[model samples]
Target: MADGIDQLPVVRTITCSHPSHAGYEKDFSEFWTGAPDSKLTNRGDTKKWNGGFRGRPALADALWPELRNYLIGRKPSIFNNAITALRAFWRFLDGYERYGMEPISQLSDISTSLSILWLNPIDEMWSAHSRQAHEIIGVLVRNARKREKMQSAWAWHPYPRAESTESKELPTEGQIRTAMHLLKQSAYGIYARWKRADAMAAEGKNLLTVSRSRQGERNQKGQLKRAFDFELTEADAHATYRAFIASSGNPLPSMADLFVALGLNGKDYPPWWPTYSQDHPQAGQVVR
Candidate 1:
């Protein structure tokens, strides 16, 4: 008869969680999207908003808690570094999904059987966090019954720990030449803009306005036919009256007639100026 044998029973040794690993919260999936704005502040455990660890709420829930618990009370530095490293691993998993392979539902799903996948392509390390990625997975999934007995899960370690390449990487001649050409062009553009601004500032023209005074701006008398912007405040009105009294006579009847002979270009002014000037022409008329 063909086998009537049932699958063998399994027993686990490590608890994968310890009493000492008790400081941080289990669910940090909220840190993925609406980060600091999501009512949770970064207090030694969670990080602030970042593009890392985004768009996978379910995977984040499954993995982040165990990772956080792995080094919660022990080493804050490694925990922070692992945040970045783990995100790279998550992106790797995304690639794993795109290939139409069986998706990993949990941390333990990454068995040692898949070790060859990490080694075959030399450039695969570009998407991973190097050796630290192994350490991150090992620490997160290894939950011993007791704190002292805890060890990294062997399933993840042997893979990303591949040896370094034989030779050093260097830029090619073409790459160097193109880089130099681009830098030179950028410098020339910056110098041209700086010289233009310097020339504009030299002429009594407002450097920000970037316009020079033209021949059309000058009247027949050769005077600059520009509008004089004078705003009268309480202090200014008082100062004008004081200047008039001290000199024995103000040249203008009121502040109103000051701009009357020199007409406004349909601009707004205090209504009282025109009112005072219109009401009494000879009231305060004086010598030039």
Candidate 2:
């Protein structure tokens, strides 16, 4: 079975007596008997390959489409036993009768000349059906050889040479959502501030406005038309009175000067103001 590996015929029958099929049989034998047995079971030959070449487990009948979709859609065309084993195994089994049916007289003998081309897979026939099967087998062979090399190379080297792979902490879903929300909110705030500044510059810089009249008389009534009259309002009297008391010795502005500056008169002034003292000893002249 091992010699003339390329010319080895398709599996005609799987039986315990033939030690020929050992590639995947060992691992699969455990499935049928639960415990590993000495050799292949009598039932092993009769058992349907069911996609498992040696002893692989059967795929659930319902998931065939999902499995097919997944395998076909996968990138890089994964060429592993899980992908190609079942189909090739079944093909070999079904084609068994047709392959052996040919007359023995018609069989070619390589007694005289050797075809080293067969020993080395010729590129011309690389895409051939039989050769494609070998190609898949070659992938497994190359993988096994690579693993063997890695194992042998590492045998004498340090055991802990492989760098430890540390797991990283990734942000949570909530954190991602929060970050997006904050970015959008910050963008809106910046835009609002820019628009507000533009609007403020367009109209004289003001965040609030009071009613105004275009052609009103310049009297106490005109106070209503002033753009900013907070200093002339009723609150202004109280604030000014407090300031005057606070600055009593600092030389107060004369009553006439105050009336002119504040758009007021001694006539319109409250009764308490007429008696107020203007005679500070230090006040040689009122500071208007």
Candidate 3:
């Protein structure tokens, strides 16, 4: 991300066409069957009008007639993004339909003066719906004007450019479940570390002098290292830190002094021991 990482495993949802081939579909059946098909079918002879548009009754009656022109020569990828934006724009307008629908009618008639809808999207990248819908409307009106031997309307850009969009749909249930499972595993790992600290404190009497018999340990990067010759326990160092508080009477404490008090040889410490010890805070002078 240019800003920062929002979530891992970049995932998205895609929208597909659904058939409403019963009501207004009949009125536009010929249009769908007529020509160079949409990018959805790779513009093949096979005809369809992307999930049939149930154009509002008597409103924007010319939209269905000019839809084929909108789909003509559109790239499939661009078409998908356009359709997705349209769907999002459509849902977004329901709340303000009184201010919206008229733009469709004006698509085929400049004389049909009406205000265009203001689409305020949450994510700026999703603002493409305005341009996409406007361009499609321009195609419809310009062609309709041509048929009547009238001057075509200028295809003016209505909104600023935004990043390409796929769809505005949220993540699916499967994606949520996968994230939850990974998070649970991470939580367990943290719990295990805390348990290890507790166990070391409880069994401080049986501390290990050398850990040569134990398995090799892994570092933060998961790299395996040679088995340690000495094991450091958290309890003693934690105790040392509480008592290691330096004062005017007591000089500052070094980790070297911490090691001697704990009765452990520094040479026997593993590569990871320095980091581990700092976290546990070993002390040599603080002991006897």
**Local accuracy of candidate 2 as per-residue lDDT tens digits, 1-288:** 111112322332212222343332212222221222123448755434222222222221222323333334333333234344434422232232233321111102110001111222121221113434434433332243343342111001111134466768777999977875675465345434333322333333121122323343354433323324332322233234323322332223455544444444433442222121244232333212
Error of 1 at 127 (Å): 0.9
lDDT of each: 0.39, 0.30, 0.38
Q: C-alpha displacement of 83 in model 3, angstroms?
A: 3.2
Preferred candidate (lDDT higher): 2 or 3: 3
Off by over 4 Å in 2: 1-52, 56-82, 85-130, 150-288
Q: lDDT per residue, candidate 3, 148-192, as tens digits?
A: 554311222244456687888887899977875665455344334
Residue-level lDDT for 92 in candidate 3: 34
Weakest 10 consecutive residues, lDDT, candidate 1? 1-10
Instruction: List TM-score per model, in order.
Output: 0.33, 0.16, 0.26
Q: Count clashing residue pairs per candidate.
A: 5, 0, 5
Clashes of 3: 5
What is the TM-score (0 to 1) of candidate 2? Answer: 0.16
